[model samples]
Target chain A: MTQLRKALRPSTKALPEYTRGHNRSLVLQTLYRDGRRSRADIARETGLTRVTVSALVAELIAEGLLVELGQREETRPGKPATLLDLDRSAFVIVGLDLSEHSVFTGALLDLDGAISTRVEVELAGSTGDEALAKVVDLAEQLVAAATAPVLGIGVGSPGVVDLGGVVLSAPNLGWNGLPLQALLAERFGVPVVVANDANAAILAEHSFGGAASDAMLVKIGHGVGAGLLLGGTPLFGSRFAAGEIGHVVVGTDGGAVCACGKRGCLETWLSIPNLHARLDRPENADARERDVVLREAGERLGIALAPVVGALDLGEVILSGPTDLLDGALASATVETLRNRTMAEFHGSVTLRMTALGPDIVLRGAAVMVLSSRLGVS
Target chain B: MTQLRKALRPSTKALPEYTRGHNRSLVLQTLYRDGRRSRADIARETGLTRVTVSALVAELIAEGLLVELGQREETRPGKPATLLDLDRSAFVIVGLDLSEHSVFTGALLDLDGAISTRVEVELAGSTGDEALAKVVDLAEQLVAAATAPVLGIGVGSPGVVDLGGVVLSAPNLGWNGLPLQALLAERFGVPVVVANDANAAILAEHSFGGAASDAMLVKIGHGVGAGLLLGGTPLFGSRFAAGEIGHVVVGTDGGAVCACGKRGCLETWLSIPNLHARLDRPENADARERDVVLREAGERLGIALAPVVGALDLGEVILSGPTDLLDGALASATVETLRNRTMAEFHGSVTLRMTALGPDIVLRGAAVMVLSSRLGVS
Candidate 1:
């Protein structure tokens, strides 16, 4: 038994080199999750040596980002251990969600993924310059309320967004070729990441909500859009217009015209505005009548989505936007249509769920985008 | 100076741990391309030590894959070094291109990616089981003729191919839910890989042909399909039907019905057979008249592909399969239509070129698929 143990052990005491950065990340994650722990306890939990753990802990403490919390009780040990934890008031991030009709801005963050502070402001105008001013003004308010240093800003818009923070096109917003990232960066004097609103919402759900696994989040509002998560990473197509399922033609004829100059688009009949328009007859002008229109719209939405659902074999489909408009009967009708159109083999196999982040999903996802890009954590 | 030289020398005599496998691959690739080299020559070119080169060469030779040639010219103050080269007869791979009309089988290759043998058989019936039997029989004949050990078999088909080797739906071939991989594997008692034909062609182009950069290859033969290569890896959508651009509607009305139960599909207007039917009068049929019809068909094909050409912003579009049908006039029309419909900014920016792989592209691609799968290179 002694010989076998000796044989199994490596001859040298030197640690493998590639695992250094990985071990550092693990230690940081552990400290973030557990608050504070003694060096010996960290070693046992992470399967790292005391010497390695002590070195990392000492380096972090020296950086002023983490601190030692004195000694802990010695339990069946020769010496007491020093406890360490992340300094919670280290940094904060700003999140912004820009839409055609509204602009939402907020800030809430922690090293271990917790909300510390949040603020939102309604936009009086939807012009490009006006929207930008509102975003900066709200960010300032959030910054004033924050106790931690502001790290960076993350903004989510509705359009074909490139990695460089440019909005190539946003039909609903009547914008074209806007350098959104450069504007935000110039305003705040910090790193800014701009992504599509639907893409950001999916990221939020994937990171913190029920649809956290490999899934697809479809945002149904003024225009239909989708964000795809494959293998835990967002998939951006060749031209960044990958998730524009709204333009896909589901009906051959008699479908409403779309803003894209195309007829019979999925967005034409399924969008909230279109549904409301269809239901605003003289006889059905009340809220109760509007509810009936919303339900019918959901049924049409499911029919349009059946091919996509069958094609991707996605595990979950998450919807977000105007909970009042997407109520129980509407959602149930959408599910029923989806069930009827999809292959029987996959019937009852996929889950259709609602967003958990409420109206703040896009904002939270924007914050998450900043946190992930700046700190290398998701 | 002596002390400095000693200090600069690596502490460990073995290859650097940082990129050992990568360096080994580089050496192997060099030999695969240049045929043979001496240890001193390899050291001079690869920046590797003579001792390290000698160790790898010895291991490869011992594995009965590499051969040691006679002594080469000596430039050092010592004896001449032996040259090493890969054994050309090490192994062989079978590539099969299964289409709706015919089946093409070929061997590619060892040392040189050249076809060793090839055979084409017309299918009496287009059933999955019948096609599988024909493939198995031909593969056995090739295996029996080969002097070297067979590595594996690769088949490229048209449809939604799963990683599990099932053909989900091949409408053109009247196939659905066919276990192609298992059928071939059980019959031949060898490893088999099934891939989408368009995807296979794209891989071939990316690895060996001129469309090596980030490009999209649209194979327009009996059917219209697209293969996208982004960052050198095939982009399979969440549901694996990502590049199904054939079904995208190009015409609003007065278009022929597609086999997929759709009207005015891009495929109905763009396919070779449909194009020929539209132009050729059966009463006035002749070889010269057939050429005219093919040329006219190419013109229509260009019109159908114009939107796709604009949407993806592809650097190059490669057309493969039956070049005789897609001659210069057809190509020019495609270029002309693409120029007119695409965004003005990208006008004359995209290059439309015929496939460099000839008629045997799909066959060659199938062989490459087998090689990559077995070697785990892709």
Candidate 2:
């Protein structure tokens, strides 16, 4: 380590503390991405001195964060080194999703982001304190059911959530200026993270669903919203309302009024309830009529997104909603509309697809929030 | 420093090289933002050790990057300390703006972002190799005219420029996959950066125009384009087409044709030539009629930008264009349309105003590119 420091010292002055934290994250990230490895192997992969790797590995093991996975099979005469890996099953993460139209869902997620247990509570038109009570109850149930120690808790709620985990507003849940993270942390005596549902979903798509770093995930559930991942960081915006595209009017030709008292808002066209209302009308009984309805909704969505796509030069657009509603005609229309609205030579092949994570995307994303905050190894 | 490190050591481990670079930038930024300061003052402001600050200052002064002013005059001081500042006049940056319709402009800029010399060359319908040659010739003139050592060269061109400074496509200039940066660097023997004019404009706005770290600058020239600065970093999209919103179809009710073979594109409604064509029509003679035309054009711009504003929750939208066309009625209409089209509660007060930099925004932005890349300061 000293020799390495000397060699690099000509251009780079050494500041030991920052390097240690960065290297620690690098070590965990390496194991998280590439699986188990011997200390020597980790050192080689990470370009860290073998001594440093050994010390870090030992410290991690002592903290119960890593497990010795026994020796590796060797063809040579030298004794095989003991393998080490993250203790993935040692702790459970509590994740809650409050973006659902009818129920609040909670889950026990392992470090691997796989759900070990699931629970849900019907909202039953709850609001304000009642809604807060239900969220607490659901979290309590998930915490009680965790098979291992709780690592942390993360909530993906519908609204503008600030960096400090305050839900600034969620009209559906009647939340305003709610310090959700602080409340949960005080009650559970653990770290807590809270974010917008769409934001959480984008993180899950990036971490688990193989989405690219610069991708936008549009969440079209009870409300229409989007989450942007640019250059590997989620944009929270100046007002913590990044991806709040639900109420932005789409297209010049106005349509039905939105809940926000606006005409032709994206939500009026893309929200599940609105889409159902438009498609299920008695006058639109034929399959061709339904196709047209979905296609129009898709076109509206494209209109709302085309400027964003062009402005950001985004390459991927992931739709997170009921696959039945967003697939086929609607999805195809969105692609066609985007291609027509934007410059073909510049954004000719922007990919638009449905997320495979299903409704659990927010839940998994919540887990990622906890993992990233608690261990910095998501 | 050791005591501070010990206090922070429990959670943060040290990595010398990364912290050194970070601290170097911190020092430069502190002096850049706060003006001249003593070593003690810099240490206090940046939380860096006096030893570290002294070493960095000495190194910077030796490199001709920092200047030490006379000792501070203080009534209470027993011994006054010398003040340090960036050597703002020691280097000149060459900036080129190629987004103009009929002319290419160049300037020599000091560290304070002040232009000391300016020059231009008429396009005269030049394209392809001829245009490239003109750009080289202009750069040579600026380099020769510099009164100080040339730091680097930055070009803000009208095209989809890749991260490697290659012009992927600029139909107006008939450039396709031209290695602009490499060619200029080889000819000038200095670092060269080439980016889309809009991207460069945004950088200028952030560094010199007092724009926020997370803001968008719309450059309306011969063509319409935008540059985004999110979280203090310029966003280069997956295909380097970020901020290519010029050709996005603004309204479903199509009107005039665009050069991209699209009708009612934002360019048709907001570009210099298009706006002039619509407003300068002989039959539309009255001021009210002119207001109506400009207002309608502004509404179209709002329609194109509302989705982007909502998606990113941007707070500031600075327009770079002819003030006569974008100000007053047009600017007001754009703001009004945005309010009507978006969630008023969330984006009610988004500021949309013309940039104060005028036509020189792209040129200054080009200088910022070189400043930020070469010195990690802007």
Candidate 3:
């Protein structure tokens, strides 16, 4: 009888703390997306009472997270309203990128997601605790370089990260169930957040790159993967593997073997190493042959993503990788194949393009993580 | 300059009215999921104050939506707590299913999602306004047959339905931009909700069929389409065509042409008519040959769904169609193909099965719609 009753518990309940936290996020998100606004404007826009807005804004300003920017320009207003905005330069955020093969990059970023200082350390094929140490060292360097109080440290690693920032596995880094965030927080005495590199890349795209809320960012680097942002929130899935599309078999006809032992996985067709290998083969010497190789890889990618775009009705697909490889032939072919494979009316409009943030996507995405977690603004 | 300011507007805001509606739904959802509970238990579970719970419960009971069900029998208690629950049978919901090729089904369902009475009308090749009339007639009959006061009417039609209950298109029924919900509401003088049949089917599976919160229901009768329930909320895409997967080309080897002018679409491989046609052919005379056809179709379905499963990390996929056709060979083949196509670790645990609701899925789903919208129960 007790078991039966226990089985009937609701999954989520709205506690007072939760509601307060939600409202804080709402306030910060409004300011982040809409720029500066007066307290009265915020109250009207968010449907909160003027008193509540005043209290929240006062608390934010006291915490050094918000700043008063004098009065708003008046046209037809009875009285001038004091404008409030995020203190973009009040604190520095330490961002770490552990996704590169030969280097680990770290940066100090402002609240506006602009890099203030950058540093790097050679990985030299380090693994396990060695790689972990390098990450900590790089983060420390970035922290030391910050001009203002450090807000938080955010790391974007190559693996399946849980809600607690535990990297379940990253075969290349020899990490499994590593408590990276807790270790960093203990060292830095600040809040720390960690996520998969692709996940972080999509956040960077969403927060600073002007991507749609309902979009997918396919990171095609050392190994292929994707990150999804649906309805302005990232989908972490039931097991934190929502965008693990690299190992999905894309080709019906047999192809080169994948590291996971799958013969025709999406990674086998679309990964950087594999794409370059196929293009550089002796048989594919001419420009037309190279185009065919890229087009075929793009078609395979389209085949894999068509169902996802159809199922979720995604608004766009952004490729975060080398423009020399993904732009032109491969990108156009992906769009063409997507148009053919999916329902034309519903999915034909799904935009496919390269990321504009360049190589610093993961670094910027890490800053977004820190901003969203420590300040409730993404 | 005006356009620039408008562009910066946040997509959503936490309005007080929205919060009140959310809290109301949270209270009802708690009772719906956890069965009978006292106002104190409700307050503790929802983190609302005792006064708020008492006021909400009083209002709900006064509205005939909830009922006081005597005191709890406690061994050690100073005062016995009064238990409360939904008035499950106080009002009836009229649910209509218009996906059948030859008939339209309607039912009078209690708040518990149990069918109290059922009715049907032959479509008989009707199209346009004639088909719409049959749907209205069916709904009218179900409303008339209700044993209690009507809560609302819900219609599960085949088409792209907008949030405004407009059917954007349904070629077989010749419906385009039809305000079916409004027309029905005008005639019946009740709140009406309309959605795609597949969408409704997924709701039934989530609310009463014991499906996971992150699951997909694939409807494969006259067409092959899917409905997604992510985090217990149905995903109606930007254009309300999130599950429009019928025209997605599933076969890379290129088999039969589809009605959508595509080759080897999911409809061609997995639709009931297509499957039956292939199985009944002279080439598939033997049972073993029939199994091959079923397995091939299932493989094609798996091919199309592998990316979706990988991208979303869905916990399960439920096939809502004829069990005799989808069970055994086809179902097992789908599971096997999915295993082969997706990553071994992340997607290996995804369950694939036939829905236990049998043929009344859409009818029950429509009831769920009414339950959710009118009383915020589902």
Candidate 4:
């Protein structure tokens, strides 16, 4: 144990190959994080010489990964320098989301995370292999529509996904030990990243949504789950199931049993159908009545989440669901309950908001996976 | 919010000063992680050329940080090469733990995390500034005993500690906003790191103890708190207050109130005194009686920890407290409860163990902070 622990310690990079990769990653990551930069800016930010930066830039430009965006004229500099930016339209990323209740959705996203083409296939009561086939069919349609080279395919499924691109378990899709990444990579001839849908949403939030360094996203729909981002990276636990919060038992008084055999689980209270049932949907309920019902559900979620907020000292919690239900009284109720329950130091500070990205979150998040893994740019 | 998020983005290291610092830290980290290696081997491992590695090794040797450890026999195609290793006795680090009940203890730790000298000043009716003064006195004694140059001071204090070394509300010692890091650094003329005691202990486990990449350390004593490690690093939140789990509410039918104004908080159940009180200690108790009492307390703790396990999918939960009370039946009950309450996927997989370092965990963890921040080696 001692020797193994010692051997697993981290080391730095300095070898020529390592340096080249590191420098290349540095330039791309810099542009991704800080947006477009002039050659001098890239060199200065990366601690690389102008010659090395220029050489890397030329290679990237030749490869169609980077493009010149005119020049940034400086008043106090010797000469104006041309700026380099990611060629957003030169390549496409196919992103798939399998968290939806009855749809297998896929979209073609460019370097900027903008969805250029989207395709969907209804599950139509499909399950298991049939559903998997539907997802592949949708992805293929999206891929065919993309004019640029597809860099990779990223799938955000509902399950425990490992770094090796295997789905350890997806109860919704009845997938266990599925080499979905390998399958997609083989069929599409591109790199693939398969992550939990909630985790994917977290990456998307970090990439585009207003996520702080430490943030959590809770998606409430057919099933309730969460994605955790701690210290600027996704928190994939020992089993790559770090953000699997849906089945956690919330209260002691037994309510509806969850699929996992847990009573009063978070999912039982927050899942859309369960929520509607709990609310006792009145016939043709008005906005006021619906707001009142949704608010109660949100409070239940907040009570369930108090421990998570207090334990992790998280800065924010973004809720994703139907906008009308999640953003109005429901969000307010959640914020109020969370504030009253958590430590006073965090009161009114743990911001709770509806996700801004809507249904496109997981899809864009999948694209983020490809960009990060393939280009080291996130 | 847009500009703020952009400003918070981490940028690549640049400038000559930063580059030199990065390279030096990389070499030291390599030695710390990979252990003894020839300059050529280090060059290859670090992606640095032989010339660069040789020069760095020479500089390190002159600084008494690295020492040649004889030469390797001809086991390869080329000539046998000399080996370089960290000079374990080259420098000393002062580690202090402020989480103990009655004393402020400090120790002189070598590069290999061995305790060379230990000193303690009992907090005999001391409070506030007097208690802070006693800690300084103890550290001074330990630092003076070191024959080697003191590298830095690392302190693991109870309460909310910020990155700037300020103790933000430590109720036990009546400390609030005490600039302990600056105070220690100024007095010692060395770098100083002050972290939450639990966080420091997590670092210690990662450094010397057998800790998985994703692990949690729960310290139960005068107070109950946890430290979380995700993806091989401490999960410090936006405010550097992650893993403050003591105040999280545990049970549904509330038992007692916590200091944080929360009812049935984990602290009410898991704190050492609370646990013993709840057990109603029997006189001349048999092993069976003790096991029953301890098991009850352990079960309570498990109930409190179920949400955490489910949310994060943690692989291990380490308990640091009185081994006599924590091990045996209590540990089993906690394990059982945790397994039963958490997802079935984690059944029999979540390991629960007592700290290998015992009460010295936070102290060693303090050394880990110095190793990581000052040397980038942990």
Instruction: State residue A161's C-alpha deviation in candidate 1, in Å.
Output: 3.3
- How does chain A of every candidate compare to the true chain A by TM-score? 0.83, 0.96, 0.91, 0.90
Locate the minimum summed-lDDT window of 10 residues in model 2 chain A: A1-10
lDDT of 3 by residue, A252-358 (tens): 88878889998889998998988888888999999999999999989998989999999998989999998998998999999888889999878889999999999
Error of 1 at B144 (Å): 3.7
> Per-residue lDDT for B1-378 in model 4, tens only?
232223223344432222445667779989987677888788788776677778778777766778899988876687789988988877788999998878888999988788978988899868799998998898889877888777788999988899888998788898988999999888877778999999999989888889888888988897788898877878767776777777766656776877777687777777888877756666526767767778866887786677778777888999999987888888899889887766777434889998898888998999989888776787
**Can you write out model 3's per-residue Cα lDDT over B210-308, one digit (the tens) per residue?**
999889999989988889988788988868888999999884778788888989789998999999899989999999999999998888888899999
Q: What class would a CAPRI assessor give candidate 1's docking?
A: incorrect
TM per prediction: 0.70, 0.96, 0.93, 0.89
Clashing pairs in 1: none
Per-residue lDDT of candidate 1, residues B98-188 (tens digit): 7535554555554345687776666776566666667777777777777666666778788778776788878667678888888888887
What is residue A141's positional error in candidate 1, in angstroms?
2.5
For A263-372, candidate 2 gives per-residue lDDT tens digits of 98998888999889888899888999999999999999898899999999888999999999899999999999999999899798999999999989999999999888
Worst 10-residue lDDT window for candidate 3 chain B reads B1-10
- Which ranges in model 3 have alpha carbons more than 4 Å from their true place? A1-19, A72-79, B1-19
Quick one: best TM-score, which candidate?
A: 2
